[model samples]
Each structure stands twice: as structure tokens, then as C-alpha cells.
Target: MFFSQLINLKEDDSSMQFIIITHDAEIFDDSSVENIYKFESAPDGTIVSRL
Candidate 1:
């Protein structure tokens, strides 16, 4: 599985990190995801909200 592969890669290098952007709400269901954020653009400027 993709998550399992990611786990292996992280174990091989403890300092590794990743920036994965996806529309799938399933990603948020994973416990390993330490942080979550939403990004959007508006007439004023770009806005980011931490979920």
C-alpha cells in the first residue's frame, strides 16, 4: 500500500518529510499526518487555513 511504502521510506531516513496535496478526505483520516491546511485564492490575495 502507498501508506506502507511511505512508512518504510520514513524509517530508512528519520529526517524525511513530505508535502502531499490531494482532494481525497481520506488523507486526513491517517494518524501520521501531523498537520493539515487548506489553501485558496481570493480577489484580495491567497488565503490559508489550518485545519
Candidate 2:
């Protein structure tokens, strides 16, 4: 999953942070992130998913 926010440069002096939760540890393999979460899943290919 991905999370992002828009901030006004004229109002905020610091950058925004986001939180993400995922069942796979490999999701961050070739990506950079601010945070991460991991969990196990069933092998049937469909065990509850979200966009």
C-alpha cells in the first residue's frame, strides 16, 4: 500500500510523513519508504486484498 499527502511550502516548514501497511516484506524491495509493516498470507492467491 502507498500513502501520500500534499503540503503547502509556504505554510509548512517540515516535510510530511506517511504510514503504510503490507502483508509482504518484499514490497519495499526496489522502493524507498518512510515506514513498513509485514504479515503472513494464505497461498491460495486470494486471501483478502485491497487497492
Task: Report the backbone clash tally of model 1.
Answer: 0
Computed on alpha carbons, the lDDT of every model, listed in order, comes to 0.74, 0.53
lDDT of candidate 2 over 1-51, digit per residue (tens): 333324443365876765555456686776666555444467865454332
Task: TM-score each candidate.
Answer: 0.65, 0.34
**Per-residue lDDT tens digits of candidate 1, residues 1-51?**
676786776645566566878777575685677788888889999898988
Q: Candidate 2 clashing pairs? A: none
Q: Which runs in model 1 stand beyond 4 Å of their true positions?
A: 10-13
Worst 10 residues of 2 by lDDT: 1-10
